[model samples]
Target: MTELNLELTKEIELLRLVTVGSVDDGKSTLIGRLLVDTKGAFEDQLLAVRKKKGETKIASAAEIDLAMLTDGLSAEREQGITIDVAYRYFATPKRKFIMADCPGHEQYTRNMVTGASTASAAIILIDARNGVMPQTKRHTHILSLLGMPHLIVAINKMDMVDHDQATFERIRQDITDYCAMQGIKDLICIPMSALNGDMVAVRGENMPWYDGPTLLETFESLPVLGQLDEQAFRFPVQLVNRPQTADLPDYRGFMGTIASGTVKVGDKVMVLPTGKSSTVKEIVMFDGNLDEAFAPQSVTITLTDEIDISRGDMLVRGDSMLEPQKEITANVCWIGDEPLEPRKKYWMKHTTNTLKAMVTDIDFKTDIHSLEHEQSDQLAMNEIGQIQLKLLKPIYADTYANNRATGSFILIDGFTNNTVGAGMII
Candidate 1:
C-alpha cells in the first residue's frame, strides 16, 4: 500500500459501542436503521428481514421488520424480546463501528454488563411515552459504575408522542437529573424516532424544532477516550518463547499484549511478583522489528537479562512503585444462577493471571431503584455489591478507575468453571 493509503487506514478509527434500554425501547430497530441507512447491511440480509412476519414498519414506509435484523435467535423472535447480546458491524466514510445490541429485560442484565464492559460509549434508548423507566435507571447506574466515558440518551419513538417538544423536554430533564445523581460526566440527549429515521442517520422533518447532531453525527464526532499509551506501562506475560533450534539456540523472548502504556527497545523494566529488573533488547514482530510498541499490541521482546519470568508475571517500568497484594476490595456484579455467599472459593482471573480466591465479606448491595446502599450478607443474580477478596497469590494491579485493563477481573465457579461474576478493583 502507498504511504497515503497507510495513513488513511490509520486515521479510520474504530468505535466500540453498545445499545441499552428497557424492553421494546427500539434498541434493535435503531441498529437496523443505522445498517440500512449507512448501506452496511447486505442485500441478502435485507431480503431475509423482509420475509419475516411482523406488523412493525419504519415510519410510514414499506413493511420491513427492522428489529429482526439484530434479533437473530429463534427464541428472541418468538418472545419478541432480546435475550442475548447481538453484535453488528457497520461503517461510514468517517468511521467504523462495532455495535452490541444488549438485552433489556431485568433478568438478562448480566448479558448487558457483558456487552457494556468493553464499550467506549453507550446509546441508551428511552421510550418517549414511558419516559425514564426502572429498567432504564438500572442500566444507567450500571453504565456509570462501569466508568463509561460517553453516554447518548436517544429518546426513541418520538413519532408515537406526536413529535411533541414538551414531552421531549420533560423526558430529557428526567434523564439529565438521574445521570447527575449517578455522577456521569459526559452525556448528550437526542430526540429521535428510530422507526421513522428522525435524528438517526437522517434528520427527518418531524422534529425540526429540536436541532442537534444526528445520532450518526454524534457517534462520528464523540471524542475517543482511554488512550492506552498515555497510562503507565503494564505488560502481562502470556508466554515465554524459547526455540531450541540450532540457528537461534539462545533466543528467549517474553510475549504478550501491552495491556497499557508503551515500551521501547532499551527501556528498563521490572518483572512483577519477582522484582527482577531488565532492559528491553529487541521488540520483535512477524513483519519486522519495531522501535517501540504500545498497549493492545501483541509482540515479543527479548530482554537484556533473563530472570526466570513465566506466564502470569507482569512487566512494568523499572522505577515503577506498583505493589502486588493478596487482599483487595472491589465492586462486583454477580451473574451466576447461584447466590454468592461469603467464605466461598472461586477462581479469579485478572489479566493473564488466574488463581484461587475467596469472597470474605459483602460490604453492601446497591439498590438500583433508589441508588441506595443496603447492608447485605450475600449477592444474588444480577446484583451489584462491594466485596472483599483474598487471593491465593499476589498480583500486580491498579484501581479500575485508573486502568481498566489491569484492574478488572472475572470470577469462575469452581465446580462448573463458568464465569459467575465480574469485578472492578476499588
Candidate 2:
C-alpha cells in the first residue's frame, strides 16, 4: 500500500461493537439490515438470502430474509435463533466496524460474554410491542459489569405498532430508567423497524415526532473509549525467539502484543517474577524496525541486557509499580454445566500465564432480575458471583477496571479441558 493510502486507512478508525437483545428481539434482522443497506453484502450473499425467504419470520414473502446474513449456522437458521457469536466486518467512508452478533437465548449467555468482552459499545434491541423484558435486563446488567462505555437502545418492530410515538416513548422511558440504575453514563435511543429498514441505516417516513440520529449515523459518530497507550505498559511475553544461525547466532527477542502503554527504543523495562531490568535495544516488526510501539501491537523486542525471561513472563516499564500476587479476588461468571466446587483446583489462564488455582471462597451470587447480592455456597450455570482464588504460582496483574487485558482470565476445567468460567480481577 502507498503511504497516503496507509495513512488514510489509519485515519478511518475501527470500532468494535456487539449487538445483544432478548430472544426474537430482531437482533439478527437489525444486523442484516445494516449489512444490506450499507452495501456490505455481496450479490451472491443477497441472492442466497432471497432464496431462503421462506425461513424469515418478520419479513414478508415478497421480501428477502436479512437475518440469514449473520445466522450462518444451519442450526441457527432452522431455529431462527442465534446460538453462537457471529462476527461481520463492514466499512463506510468515515469509519469501519467489526460487529459481533451475540446470542440472546438464556442458555447461550456465555456466548454473549465472549462477544461483549472486547466491545467498546453495544446495541440493545427491544421489541416495540414488548417493553424491557427479563432477558433484556440480564444482558444490560452483564454489559454494565463488563464496563461497556456506550450503549444504543434500538426499539425495533415499530412498524407493528403503526409507528406510534406513544409506544416508542414508553419503551424508551423504561430502557432509560433501567440503564440509569445500571450506572450507564452514555446512551442513545432510536426507534427503528429492522424489517422495513426505517431508522436503521436510513431515516424513513415513520415516527415523525421522534427525531434522533439513525443507527448508522450514531455508530459513525460515537466516541470511542480512551486510547490503550495512555494506560500503564504491560507486555506479556508469549514467545522467545532464538535463531542459532550463523548470520545472527546471538539474536534473542521477546515477542508478544503490548497489553497497554507504549515503548520506545532505549526505554528501561523490567522482567516480571525475576525482577530483572534491561533497556530496549530494538523494536522489530515484519517490515522493519520501529522507533516505538504501543498497546495491541504484535512485535518482537530485543533488550540491551540478557535477562532470564520466557513465556508467561511479562515486561513492564522500569518504574512500574505492578507486582506478582498469589491470591486475588475476582467477579466470576460461571458457564460450566457443573456447579463451582470450592477448594477444587482449576487451571487459571491470565494473559499468557497458566497456573493451577482454586476457589478459596464464594462471596455471593448476583440475582440477575433484581441486581441484588445473595449469599451462596456454589455458582450454577450462567450465574455471576464474586469469589476468592489462590494461585499455585504468583503472576503479575491489575484490576479489571484499570486494564482489562491483564485483569481478565479464564478458568479451564482440568478434567474436560474446557473453559468453564471467566473472571475479572477486583
Candidate 3:
C-alpha cells in the first residue's frame, strides 16, 4: 500500500493521561472541573457535590463543587483527599480521553506509579502556593523514567497565588530545567486553577497574561502514536489453542496481542529462545482471518510448521534484530518494603515469561530532588536504581527505550508473591 493509503487508514487512539502531584495540588479537582465544563458530569452528581458544599473549599455559591465529580469514595469525600486512582472518561470533538486521577500522598506513590505506567502523557499538578515540593520532583522523575512521551506541568490553583505572573514563570523555568536534566524534550507548562475553572476546560478570563493552550486544547491537538506499527513485529504468545476434536484434529493456533509492527500470511517468522523457524499460514480472529495484522491486535495464528511453542514464547520476523539473552542490565524501581540488595532472589517476569533471578549488583540510584545519580548498595521502598541481574533462563528482550511492551519486566517476591519492583532493560 502507498504511504498515503496507510495514513488514511491510520487508527485514532484514546489518550491515556495521569494527573499527579503533592497533597492539595488539585489532581482530582482538575479532572472534576474538566468533566463539569465539558458537560461530562451528570446532573445527579452535580446535585450531590452541591449538597456537600459545607465540606468543600470551592467558594462559588451557586456552582456545584467540581471536586465531588471525582473523590467518589466515602472516605475520600469525608477527608477531602484522594486515596485511589479515580478514572473519568470524556470526549471532545477531536479526541477521546481516559484520565487517571492518581493520589498525591506519599504512601500511595505505588498506586500513582501504576496509573502512569501505560500513559503516553502526564499532567503534573503544582500548587501555586507550594511550588516544586519533593513530591513534585519525585513524580516528574517517575514519569520521565517511565518513558512518558509528554509532560505538562499544570501549575494549578493559581487563584491562591492571586494569579501572579512571577509565580507562574518561576515554576515553569524550574520544571523546564528539571525535565531537561532528565533528557525529556516534550515538556509543556501551563498555568491554571482547577477549583475556579481558569485555563482548564474553558478560558476563564482571569488569566489574560498567560498565552498558551488550555488543557482541553492541549489534549485535542496532541498527535497520536503509530510508531509501534512501524517497528519490528513482536508477538508474545499468551496461550496455545489446540482444540483437538474430531472435526479439527490437526489444528493448532498461537494466541496473543501483537506487541509491535505487522505480519501477514507467508511472512517468515522465528520462535524466540528456541531458534525454530516457520511461515505464517493463517491469521485468525474471533470473526475471521485477516490478510495482515499489526501491533495491539489480538489474534490466533497458525504457522506452516508445528514447532515446539507455548505461552511466554515470543514470535518475531526471522530477520528482526531483537536478541535473546540470560544476563541483562536494567534500571529497576524497588517497590517493596525490603531493599533490593545483592544475593536477593525474586521471580523476574518479562513479557509472558517468568524465571528465577538474583540481584547481582547495584549500579546507582537517582536522587529525585536533585536528579543526581548516587552510588548505593541497596534500594529501599519506592527507590529507583540501576541493577544487574542473573536470570536462570534466557529470554528475548530489548531496551525499554526501543520497545516498551517487550523491554519491561516486574520482580515478584519469592515468599509473598507480590510484585516487588519494575524493571526496564537497559
Q: Quote each prediction's TM-score.
A: 0.92, 0.91, 0.88
Highest TM-score: which candidate? Answer: 1
Alpha carbon lDDT of each predicted model: 0.86, 0.85, 0.82
Q: Which stretches of candidate 3 lie over 4 Å from their true place?
A: 1-12, 51-69, 72-81, 129-131, 160-167, 208-211
TM-score for candidate 1, please give it: 0.92
Candidate ranking under TM-score, highest first, comes to 1, 2, 3
For candidate 1, the clash count comes to 0
TM-score of 2: 0.91
The top-ranked prediction according to lDDT is: 1
lDDT of 2 at 309: 92
Least well predicted 10-residue stretch by lDDT in candidate 1: 54-63
Indicate the residue-level lDDT of 152 in model 3: 86
Clashing pairs in 3: none
- Tens-place lDDT per residue, model 3, 1-426, is 122344433544578888886446776667777776666666666767774544434334236655666768888789887677878887665567888877777545576678887777889888888888877788878887788878888998899999999999999988888788878899888899888888887778889998899998898767656387898899999999999999989899999999989999999999987888999999998888998999888999999997999999999997885676878899887779888898999999889888999999998988756768999899988788899999998888978888889989999999988999989998
Model 1, position 130: C-alpha lDDT score: 94
Candidate 2, superposed: residue stretches over 4 Å from native = 1-11, 51-62, 78-80, 162-170, 207-211, 223-225
lDDT of 1 by residue, 1-426 (tens): 112355565678888999987548877678778887877787666766774455333332224566677778898789887678888898777788888878777565697789998789999999999999888888899998888889999999999999999999999999999899989978899999888889988999999898889999998998664676889999999999998899889899999999889999999999888888989999999999999999889999899986899999999997655887899999999999998999999999999999999999999999878879999988999999999999999978999888988989999999999999999998
The reply for model 1, stretches above 4 Å from the true place, is 1-11, 51-62
